[model samples]
Target: MKIRMRTIGLIGYLTLLMLPIYWMLNMSLRENNDIMSRLAFYPHHPTINNYVQIFTDPSWYMGYVNSFAYVGINTVISLLVALPAAYAFSRYRFLGDKHLFFWLLTNRMAPAAVFLLPIFQLYSELGLIDTYLAVALAHTLFNVPLAVWILEGFMSGVPREIDETAFIDGYSLPRFFLTVFLPLIRAGVGVTAFFIFMFSWVELLFARTLTITEAKPIAAVMTRTVSASGLDWGLLAAAGILTIVPGALVIYFVRNYIAKGFALGRV
Candidate 1:
């Protein structure tokens, strides 16, 4: 009886989770009339027109390109910077080390709105406003700290004797990290990359303020659907559905590493 009840609960939870996604898919494949006529559990007559429109439209596709370009760059930069910072925090003690670590994390706590004007001014002076670099750099300010905290925890779990052993085997610091330390932390890296991608991908305020036509992200473009004609429900729903694809693909690829990543520092 207990097992049966548990099975029923699991099924119920899955149903609740999938129901909304099913609704969105249903709405995307549906015509305007079907959406307006009644609450639809599924579309009566399915059509791929929305998806087709997305591919054919330059504005729509541009958003995808811009979003991916910046988010990808931000992820790489975050990982590169955070890996070393995390290692230092985990392995060494320096003057004011604790204060510096906390200071680094304070960047994450800052509201983006507080820095918008200063960031805008700084980028403008550097002639980087409205460029991919601008948004990528902006995202790094927040993402790098998170990457550091996560990687630091993971690095701490690694025994210090591993480093000492590598040195005794005539391995240099760089060689030891590349061959030994990195492999052990692969799961942490995967998880960090996933989070950086997600945050930078969904963030809109900075992306919108920092970029114009040449580098506008998808989240910004989604806002334009609501014009004088009222909300383009069909197009809006289609865009919203499409937005989930990249993130879903990323999570699918990294899902296997998530548990291991979380357990890194715990042990």
Candidate 2:
């Protein structure tokens, strides 16, 4: 009886969690006319036109490409910068090390909105406006701190003896970190990369504020749904559904490592 109750509760919880996604999928298959004309749990007449338009339209598909480019850049930059910083924090004892670490995390705590103006002005001055690099760099400001926080925790768990043994064996610092130390914390890296990628992918404020057109992200482009005829509900829903796919795939591939990452890291 207890097991039955638990099972039923789990099912209910999952249904609640997945309700929005299922609704979005249902909406994506429908026309704006069909959607606004009635309220139905399922699409009475399913259509693929919404998805088709997204693929065929340059404005729509280009948004996706631009988004992917920035996300990839931010993820790589955040991880690359964080790994060394995390290692330094985990391995060394220095003046105000804890204070410095705390300061880094504080950057992550600040809302992205606060940085919007400064970033905009700085990028404008640098002539990086409407570029993939601008958005990627802006995202890195948030992602790097988080990557450091999580990576530091994982790096700390690694025994210092490994470093000593590697050095004793004449392994170079880069070689040891690449071949020996990194493998041990592979789960943490995977989790960090996923997090940075997702944050950059979904973040609209920075992405939208920084780029006008050439580097506009998909989330920002979703706003274009507002037209003289009102919102294109079907098209918007399909884009939303497609937007979710990459994040879903990232989670799926890293599902095995995510648990270990959470358990092992500061996350």
Candidate 3:
């Protein structure tokens, strides 16, 4: 009886969570006219035209390419910068270390709008506007601090004796960090990369502001679906569904690491 109740509860919870995604999928399969005309659980006249449009149209597909390009760049940049900083935070003690660590979190805490004007001006002067690098660099301001926080937690969990032992074996600092330290915190790295990717991928304000056609993200392109007539409901829904795919794949790959992170209290 207890097991049955738990099973039923789990099913109900999952249904609640997936309801919106299922609704979007349903909407994506119907024409915009069909969608706005009725409220239905399933599409009576199903179509794949929306997905077809997204694939066939350069403007639609390029938005995805640009988004992925910047997101990838941001994730790599954040991880590269954060790993060393996290190691320092985990292994070393310096004057005002706690204050400095807190300061990094404060950067993460600040709204994206706070940095928007300054970043836009700086990039404008550098002629980086409308480039993938612009949005990627802008996202780093937030992602790097978060990456450091997550990585530091995992790094601190590692024993100091590992560093001492590696040194005794004549391992150089960079070699030890790469060959030894990183593997020990692989789960953390996965978790951090997943977060950085998600944050950059979903962030619209900076990406939308920084890029025009050359580096426009899918989120920005979604805005184009709205026209004088009305919203292209089916296309909008399909784009949303496609937009979810990358994050879903990332989650699937890093699921084990995420589970471990939760177990280790580092998520």
Off by over 4 Å in 3: 227-229, 259-267
Model 2, 169-258: lDDT tens per residue?
A: 999999999999999988788888888887788889989998898999988888865554479899999999999999999899888767
* Candidate 1 structure lDDT: 0.87
Task: List TM-scores for all candidates, in order.
Answer: 0.93, 0.95, 0.94
Q: Which has the greatest lDDT?
A: 3
CA RMSD of all predictions: 1.8, 1.5, 1.8
lDDT of 1 at 234: 67
lDDT of 1 by residue, 189-243 (tens): 8888888898899888899999988899987887876664576566778888999
* Candidate 3 per-residue C-alpha lDDT over 1-267 given as tens digits, one digit per residue, 9 for 90 to 100: 999999999999999999999999999999998998889999898999999999999989999999999999998889999999999999999999999999998988999998899999999999999999999999988889888888888999899999999999999999999999999988788888888898898889999999989999998889866653378999999999999998899889988777655443254
Residue 84, candidate 1: Cα error in Å is 0.9
Better lDDT candidate (1, 2)? 2
Model 2 off-target regions past 4 Å? 227-229, 260-264
Error of 2 at 233 (Å): 0.7
Candidate 3 clashes between residue pairs 3 or more apart in a chain or in different chains? none
Clashes of each: 0, 0, 0
Determine the C-alpha RMSD for candidate 3 after optimal superposition of all C-alphas: 1.8
